[model samples]
Target chain A: MRYLLIYDITHDGTRSKVADVCLDYGLNRIQYSAFLGELSPAHQRELLLKVHQRLGKHGANIQLFPLDEKAWVGRKSIEREERQNNE
Target chain B: MRYLLIYDITHDGTRSKVADVCLDYGLNRIQYSAFLGELSPAHQRELLLKVHQRLGKHGANIQLFPLDEKAWVGRKSIEREERQNNE
Candidate 1:
């Protein structure tokens, strides 16, 4: 399933760090504060757990939105285009 | 482009009426108060105008979100599935 995770960082200087971890885990950064990702159910659970662990109690707020398939198409296209450009 | 429109009805008994109008205009109802639609630029503008006209001053609030191609994929799949199942 594809999910849109919207989060705000609680600690200082954690935006880049959190974003790096998310990218490493295959989450596509959409807006500065939001990410879009597709994961198996197992992966989704793992990712969320890892995020919580990484952020600990300082992870501001998180909203996980399970998007329908249509939402994923646009995000995937953008990711594909970005990959093709190597940027 | 695909867009998500989230709005709340201001007056009473307008939910069903508004939803009916949205369905007529090919917008997919996601949550009770949210809709996902793929619309041409022109159509989007027209739809927004029409929605405002229909709701007048009683439309609680409206937020229009433009989704990337990936996001549209999920919605379209659900829509397709719905279309396939008539019974």
Candidate 2:
């Protein structure tokens, strides 16, 4: 199944760590704090647990939205040129 | 259909304007730079146009993803406490 993961963490270190965890799970970084990709149900739960542990009362917000085939197909987007720094 | 919209805008004024546009389209603010809600296909197109116009070579990045029923139903999330300032 496909999934969209996004987060908000003010602390640079914690944010980077969470991002690394997402990458370790093979998720593609779509934005600085957003990721999208495939994962099995078990892996999804595992990822959630891993992310929860990473958060560790850091007062961050992370959401993982599972996308079925239909959702993946129905997705739409509008993107413009972004500065290299922001990208 | 459900949709997820996220953006990164450097200019404070531009960012606020873009955020207003998203809210006008009935998307609820999920994160500082993310919004989620239902939108018809036509409205989605209209929103893209409006947002595209708002960006207007400002070098901002905005993406709107339409979610199908299955995707919306299968979504997963992990949110920890957020600071009042960030909220």
Candidate 3:
């Protein structure tokens, strides 16, 4: 299933680490702190655990929203130009 | 229908304006540039049109994703603390 992942971490290092985890799971970064892509249910749980462990005791917010294929395609995005820096 | 609204605008003024539209529609801001809430399909289209108009020729990106109630509840979030500044 496809999932939309959103996170806000105060620390830069931890933020990038979470981004790395998202990339490792084959998710595409849609924004500086957001990712969207397909992942198995098991992998989704694993990713959540990884982020939870990294965020333990630290003040950060991470949310995972699973979307079915139809719902994923139903998303609407408008862009005039691509961001030069994907990071 | 629950919708996730995400946007990235180069100009701070435009970004805030887009956020205002979200709030005007009774959507809850979930991050610096994201909002989540329930809306009727007609209102959803209205919100999209508003965002699109506000974003015209400004090189901004806005995305809207509709989620069913089950999918909305299926989301998981972790936060150590609430942000002092809602804006």
Best by lDDT: 3
lDDT of candidate 3 over B20-79, digit per residue (tens): 999999999988778999989899989888987776456787778888776787898887
lDDT of 2 by residue, A11-82 (tens): 787888889889999999988789988999888888888887776557787888877766667666665665
Alpha-carbon TM-score of each model against the true structure: 0.42, 0.87, 0.87
Q: Please give the lDDT score at residue B6 for candidate 3.
A: 82
- Between candidates 1 and 2, name the one with more favorable DockQ: 2
What fraction of the true Cα-Cα contacts (under 8 Å, chains A to B) does candidate 3 also have? 0.65
Misplaced by over 4 Å in model 1 are A70-87, B1-87
Indicate the worst ten consecutive residues by lDDT in candidate 1 chain B.
Answer: B76-85
Flag clash pairs in model 3: none
User: Candidate 2 DockQ category?
Assistant: medium
Per-residue lDDT tens digits for candidate 2, residues B1-87, read 789998877778778888998899999999888999988889989888888787755677677777777667777776667546554
Candidate 2 wrongly placed segments (more than 4 Å): A82-87, B82-87
Ranking by lDDT: 3, 2, 1
For residues B1-87, what per-residue lDDT tens digits would candidate 1 score against the true structure?
767665556455554665676677788976555666777887777776666556543434554566765544433210111112234
Task: Give the docking tier of candidate 3.
Answer: acceptable
- Evaluated at residue A57, the lDDT of candidate 3 is 51
Estimate the lDDT of model 3. Answer: 0.82
Return the TM-score for candidate 1, rounded to 2 decimals: 0.42
Q: lDDT per residue, candidate 1, A21-87, as tens digits? A: 6687788976555666777777777776666556643435554556665544433211111122233
Better candidate number, 1 or 3, judged by lDDT: 3
